[model samples]
Target: MNRWVKALRAPFFTASAVPVFLGTAVAYNHTGRISVPDLILTLIGVIALHAGTNLANDYFDHLSGNDDLNPHPTPFSGGSRVIQDGLISPKGVLIYSLSWFTLGCLIGLYLNWRRPGNVILYLGLIGVFSGFFYT
Candidate 1:
């Protein structure tokens, strides 16, 4: 449980959430309305994307020996130490990352269907592609 939580990088969920809450607040201010379902879905999708990206990066960094070779690493700057600390394997991280990414895409598809703007789909595609290609 602890390992999973660490792998999720719960602290960094804020990175995924702040923009969402900000946008929600702005929309509520401007339109005087809020769609609770959309807000909840958006938060889940964003957080999943962040978690997947982090896990993928950790897997790739471990594969490339970058994490192992880092002489000095800060908690915030270095990759999560889940793999380094033997909490999980690189393969497990990659699998879990892909799972989260898939889950996020599925959620995005649902949101796009519900909203009917295709904006969510496009953004999700862009984010997933960029994250996957990022080293």
Candidate 2:
């Protein structure tokens, strides 16, 4: 469990979660109402996207020898050292990253179904594309 958390870089989820929270707050303020389920789904989707992005980055960094070359790596920089430290295999990282990306897209699809437009679909596609290719 601890290894998974480190591999997922769970601590950095705040960077993705904070925006969802602020967006929900703003929507509630404007509408005077909130859909808790949608909010929850949004949070989950965003976090999954974030986790997928982090894992993808780490895997690509490993492939590029970036993480391997780093002399010192902290929790906040140089990517997670799970692969370098042998805590998680590179293949495991890629599989987990793809799985997270799939989960995020599924949640986004559900959220889009609840909404009136295809906005979420487009956003999700863009996110996945950019994140996967970000390197």
Candidate 3:
């Protein structure tokens, strides 16, 4: 696989998107309506958030010496081995994570502007903070 692809951990994006899909479905089933643009924006924002979280985890784990000591790390236990394996630099990972996070925030701001509500802003802020501090 490509180093960039591995760094993004594309497979894990579904975990973030599933909630958005389920929520949209419930809303549609209840109201018999849906906003396609909103749905698309939500999905994009969520995927970016998830990617940022994963990158942050990889960067922090490497920084804290955890990944270095995990001799028999599994896919779920240890962080992605991209950094430890020299596939990408720690600085690169951090920058990538920050960029995704910024993108997610920008999407959230756009959603708030379109919908006129604080819910999106609050949720996005919480998700960003938690994801960045999870490790």
Backbone clashes in model 2, listed as residue pairs:
none
Candidate 2 error regions (>4 Å): none
- Candidate lDDT scores, in order, read 0.87, 0.90, 0.90
What does candidate 3's lDDT look like per residue over 45-113, in tens digits?
A: 889988899999999999999889998987776878899999999999999999999999999999988
**Candidate 2, residues 1-135: lDDT per residue as tens digits?**
677788888888999999999999999999999999898989998999899999999999999998888788888678888888899999999999999999999999999998999999998899999988777
TM-score of each: 0.92, 0.95, 0.95
Q: Which regions of candidate 1 fall more than 4 Å away from where they truly are?
A: none
> Model 1 over residues 27-83: C-alpha lDDT tens digits?
999999999988998899888988899888888888888888887877676688899
- Per-candidate alpha-carbon RMSD to the true structure: 1.4, 1.1, 1.0
Order of the predicted models by lDDT, top scorer first: 2, 3, 1
